[model samples]
Target: MGKLSNCLSMIQILMARPKVKIDDLAAELGVKPRMIRVYRDELEKAGIYIESVRGVNGGYSLDRRSILPIRNFNSTEVQELQIAIKSYLSKQPDHDSTLDNALEKIKAAQRDQALSSKHFYFANDYLINAEVGNESEHYKRLYHAFNHRKKVMITYEAASTNAVTKRTIHPYAFVVYDENIYCVAYCEQKEALRTFKIIRIHDVVLVDQSFYLPENFDIRKQFPHLGFIREPQEVELIIDTPFSNQVKESIYSTDQIIEELPDNAIRFKATLNGEQSIKKWILGMGTKARVIAPEHLKKEIQLEVEQMLQNFQK
Candidate 1:
């Protein structure tokens, strides 16, 4: 190996073993013991400092944190990227050479990285950019079913009645809304398309049977309001100070508007999809939020508060 190759090899050795003897590093790289010390000096100049221990049992070790900037993709991650790219291309009628080239480049880079370095790559599921936070096993199964046009048997809990039922569903696509994960699927039990929360799904089993997705089926057209697939309502709220700032940062609806009050509060207005989800949000804000418009919603909040007081008194 050349000078640069010997330096990288020495660093790799230090990473794998804690306190590698200078003689061992030289033997591994087919270089002199003195050359190992030279490699350490070169590495230190490149901001990768090796810690040298003293006495008989002493050797050199590299801090793992310092070398973490090296970017490398594992097999699972590379495969997931390729799958996403293909999924995207499948939707487009025209052939996109750009995305195809990108996939090839990613694969080439993965192979090159594997040959150059011995990295401890984890085969974990790639997190989908959704409000679901970390990707779960349920997400992976649903994604697989969606991609393959297969049906899945899921044990689901209903948010309204807390009813649990086992049903088979043909998942259409994954939708992220209101900091949550939802799957738009055709429910076999209901014989209609329904949106389900991924978290509420307790278990998922992939079925062998495959289904065909309708070419004209568009998720956006079907669920114009997304998760809040209900009667649309024009809602208004008076949010106080710090809490108002929080509300301003997020768009509850596409047509949302905000106005600043003299007292530093905010008057928020939006054409939200339904009253149920919006009511829950107002209640969650506690004393900092109050409903201004929609008399029915205000009365409901008042009623809920009264019920809470009565329960506490009992």
Candidate 2:
């Protein structure tokens, strides 16, 4: 961490708790106790003050009300910020050094405050076989086009058809769905809001042409399922033993209900998002889990299994 980063971290530590020992601060920041005093002096010079406690177990404390101008984030908030940084960096081919530096500072402070971190992650296994090229450059171009209200010409390979074609698009905003980054843009060819997976875009050219975004255009409202608005479907499942326990550990939906069954099985019911995601989860569990309701979903899973059997037989 740099000087500014260290100073910010020191402030974070002070604000989080009543006091921290000088030696503890030094150990957390990987510096000497004497340097801790130097940092204190530097911070006091900038109108933030730390009070010294005189005695054994003596340390430093900050009056949060006095430093109200500086925004102090709790441990949970810091963790959430880290998750956002991870999501953004995951899309780029190379790490964003600026965000990485910021993450380091936050981590230092997190350690200093003895804050327990809760991991928040998004799935990305769908991208394992993806064609990765100069993704960083493509991302930058698309971002620039979005920011400047300019159009972009992209050679995109359709995931469904595996057909590559060029199209002019008015970039709107970046959308992350099912652990993939997509550009929510107005496709001139489609004449509607469409999502193009970032990794699927093989070529990008920023066009000088300018376009205006509709003032009333809200991406979430336009594409309900992509964002906060999800049309969840009711699902019932019988999951055996450890898989049931594993499912119990996670909250698929706020209204989810679970019932203990004989032989350590569970009857689980939840209004989860989309049949596709639910179908995938059931298929992943194999014979350990079986769908109990939404008869159509049950038939679909049966069809999938039958196809798998056919493949194996062949």
Name the regions of candidate 1 deviating beyond 4 angstroms: 1-140, 147-150, 154-168, 176-181, 186-203, 208-218, 225-228
lDDT of 2 by residue, 1-314 (tens): 88788888999998887899999999989889998899999887766778899889789998553464433654445544554665565454144557768766666544323312111122222111122222356766886776578999999999889999999999876544454456778899989878788888899998999999776665545555445336567889999966777666656677989999999899999776545556766886789998899898899999999999999999
Lowest summed lDDT over 10 consecutive residues: which window, candidate 1?
Answer: 116-125
Evaluate residue 109 in candidate 2 and report its C-alpha lDDT on the 0 to 100 scale: 46
Which prediction has the highest TM-score against the true structure? 2
Task: Kindly report which residue pairs in candidate 1 clash with one another.
Answer: none
Error of 1 at 39 (Å): 24
lDDT of 2 at 288: 91
Q: Which ranges in model 2 have alpha carbons more than 4 Å from their true place? A: 1-17, 20-151, 157-171, 178-181, 186-193, 206-222, 225-232
Worst 10 residues of 2 by lDDT: 117-126
Q: Model 2 scores what on Cα lDDT?
A: 0.70
